[model samples]
Target: MSRHNIPDALWQRLEPLVCLPRKDPRGRPAKDARLMFNGVLWILRTGAPWRDLPAEFGPW
Candidate 1:
């Protein structure tokens, strides 16, 4: 995992809290919650703008 990623132990606790569906019945499928969470953490940790989020974490 990258530095921005949540550790496996922490993710196990967080995974249950994320309630988003993998597939959206009305539109595009939902993005991976773990990845999105990591992206958000990266921004918060780095104090960077959303536009600067790396591609590995998905779109900003």
Candidate 2:
């Protein structure tokens, strides 16, 4: 996890709140909610555009 990323305790709390991703017959496999949520958190925390998200976070 990144330095500014959500803590384990908070993540544990959020895990139950986050909806499980549905399987899309015609789409690629679903992404982990933790990773995607962290990506969103990074954008919100840094005020950066989705396209400008860091490489470490994977494709934008």
Candidate 3:
């Protein structure tokens, strides 16, 4: 995992709270919640603009 990635232990706890079903019949499939959450954390930690988010975290 990258330095910015959330730990597996912590992510296990947070996952249920933060994530919706991956396959939603009512709409398009959801993006990976953990990926998006880490992206948000990276931006908050670095104080960067949304456009500056790294590509590893997926589209900003």
Candidate 4:
């Protein structure tokens, strides 16, 4: 309903795929992997800048 045009279904599938594997080689915690994946998808889908993503979804 906002300027964010990424589809809901596409995002749903991507959410889990993006959230997993958050562990780093050194066991360091990763930031919101979900947001990162979503950002990348958004860029590819809508060609929008990563910095332009909504604050509520968090940053890439």
Best-fitting candidate, measured by lDDT? Answer: 3
Candidate 4's C-alpha lDDT?
0.62
Clashing residue pairs for model 2: none
Number of the top TM-score candidate: 3
Say which prediction, candidate 1 or candidate 3, comes out ahead on TM-score: 3
Which candidate, 2 or 4, would have the higher lDDT against the true structure?
2
Model 2 steric clash total: 0
- Candidate 1's C-alpha runs over 4 A off are 20-29
Clashes of each: 0, 0, 0, 0
Query: Please, what are the lDDT tens digits per residue for candidate 1 over residues 1-60?
Result: 777788999999998888545564787654687888888888989999999999998887
For each candidate, what is the lDDT? 0.82, 0.81, 0.90, 0.62
Pairs clashing within candidate 3: none
Compute the lDDT for candidate 2: 0.81
- Candidate 3 lDDT, 1-60, residue by residue in tens: 999999999999999888755564787554788999999999999999999999999988
- Lowest-lDDT window of 10 residues in candidate 4? 1-10
**Candidate 1 at residue 35, lDDT?**
88
Better of 2 and 4 by TM-score: 2
lDDT tens per residue, model 2, 1-60: 679578999999999778555666687663677777888889999998899988877799
